[model samples]
Target chain A: MTFSTDIHVDKVRALLQAMEAGDERCTVEILDDITQIRKSELHQQLSELTKNLHQTLDDLDVDTPVLLHAKHDLPDITERLQYVLNETQKASDKTLGSSENTLGLLEEVGTMLEGSDEVSKIQPLLDQASQELTNIMLAQSFQDLTGQVLNRVILIVTELEESLKALIERSRHDYDAIPQKTQSEAEQSAEHEKGVGPNVTAKSKLDAVESQADVDDLLSDLGI
Target chain B: MQINRDMNILVVDDFSTMRRIVKNLLKELGFSKFDEADDGATAWPMVQSGKYDFIVSDWNMPQMTGIDLLRHVRADEKLKDTPFLLITAEAKRSQILEAAQAGVDGYIVKPFTAATLNEKIQKIFERVAEKQNK
Candidate 1:
């Protein structure tokens, strides 16, 4: 993939000669010719670079995870994460249902013992148990919040797989033959509006409110 | 105007876990009647068809977003006055501002305590009462 720069060298020599002779018009013409030669040489170099990249990609082992990830691992990971989401949801719901049933039974027991001197002794303990059960139910909300985070991770993995597959597919053809695709403003804004899920770490906070009070203050400031 | 414990409340989120959690919190608050939707797109038709008194929705979803749903509700003459609350992990000031501008009745950041949910719902109803009184 050698580029012939002899024409470029000849053009540069002609440009220097024209400049030395103080011929302004010839100098200008030779300067334009040199610029064109340099442009074509750059184009040739870029084409060679693209060819080498394609060859390198083609030489990659078929078993490499980058290629296999698009075909197998990524979808497998997505399915596994989805399974996690489903199972956790089922567990949370089961806990919630059982707790609610227990609370109901406790209420019935409290009613059955109402107006007895024994009620005072039994009531406080029952109330404490009820509160604990409620707390347990509330704690199950972790599944929801964590599940949202997991959903985002799964989406990112799927996107990574798609990008890898696209890159691999592109490498099989002439790079410049494909027209460059840019995201339209509408598409970009639509993606922006989709909103990122919960920030997993402090670094990704992006000026987010730290607490309910901060949210309240912002809403108040907005006169809502 | 008093807060209606039996108000037809609609809970919307992409995750069933979240929908259940929000419903459980509402139950803890003594609100019994409720409906659920997985996203704003699903909720929209329900909102139009059902005589919902309030809506509690998540900000991020696949088909449609909470803010867009809020806009739709506000733009609809029939449902404009229904209370809309956003419970989401999107805590950015700009997002809060956007929800406020979209006529969201309340905003509660995610992983919120039951106390916060209770208080926000109470505050929203109080404001709604004030407006009705006016």
Candidate 2:
């Protein structure tokens, strides 16, 4: 194939130079012959390309069973992840709820003691308990943080399922003619989805403005 | 600048636990008259009824986010000047700016102490008081 293409290419170059050098009569005749030769070569290359594509597709078909099995397990993975999120949320709520109730009782006890003349005896201990309960309640805000992080993972997994399905479907199509998306296109879509969800890592480079004061300062700098 | 303990306040969050936590903290701060909504969509009509004296909302909700509620409230002539506070885990600079531009009275990041909530609410009231005095 390469030898024939090289011969055709040398012949075409010689013909073009002849046409450029004022040889007009035979140039059209030989140019038409060269066109036919180029067309036949293109047809041969196309057949080879098609054969290679079929071969790749056959290889993908061999792996289709594994892909299908993986796809089948994705939903179960999603469900288990959801279960973790829900259970953790429930535990967090129960712990925080009970702590709040205890804090409420402690507050009442402290108030009653404050109203009494015997304020010095157990007031410190009650105050300490109140502070500790408040800390426990604050700590349970971990549920919201964890939930947000889990939701981001769920988003990624959901997108992965779609990609996997698309890959499985690609095996059924003559996909060589279709233009695949570039890496930058995928990156742009990912960027659009990024930075909005919970900062799972407190040290995330995307948004390190951890405290409310920093939020205020940033907004203030933006002149909001 | 003092918060009126008896004034009606609406607490909006998608999570029931968050609403409960905010309400508990509010109770600790002596604000008892409370209405709870699961999301901003539910809170909008309640705010429009002119019953809520203050609004403390979580930002990342399902139906309508806290920013959307803030926009709706700010757009309404009846509720434009309502003291709106955002209690959210969204710590991004862009989100904070969006809420501020939507006329949020204050912003409190999540994992916050009851004391922080109290301080932010107090600061909002103080600013409102100063504006009215002006």
Q: Taking the candidates one at a time, how many backbone clashes does each contain? A: 0, 0
TM-score of each: 0.54, 0.52
lDDT of 1 by residue, B1-134 (tens): 46889899999999998899899999998999999999899999999985799999998998999889999999999889999999998876767887888888899988788999998899999988898889
Q: How close is candidate 2 to the true structure, as a TM-score?
A: 0.52
Instruction: Kindly list the per-residue Cα lDDT of model 2 for residues B6-107, writing each as its tens digit.
Output: 989999998898899999999999989999999888999889999988999988777888888999999999889999998887777666766777788888
What lDDT does each candidate get? 0.83, 0.76
Give per-residue lDDT, candidate 2, residue A165: 64
> Model 1 — TM-score against the truth?
0.54
Residue B73, candidate 2: how far off, in angstroms? 0.7
Taking the tens digit of each residue's C-alpha lDDT, what string does model 1 give over A1-224?
76555566677788889899999999999778767876887899999998998898887666554565566666667877876788789889989999999999999999999898899899999999999999999999999899999999999998987787778777673323333234596774464467766654343375678888898888887777
**Candidate 2 Cα deviation (angstroms), residue A132:** 16
* Ten residues in sequence with the least summed lDDT for candidate 2 chain A: A174-183
Instruction: Looking only at chain A, give the TM-score of model 2 against the true structure.
Output: 0.50
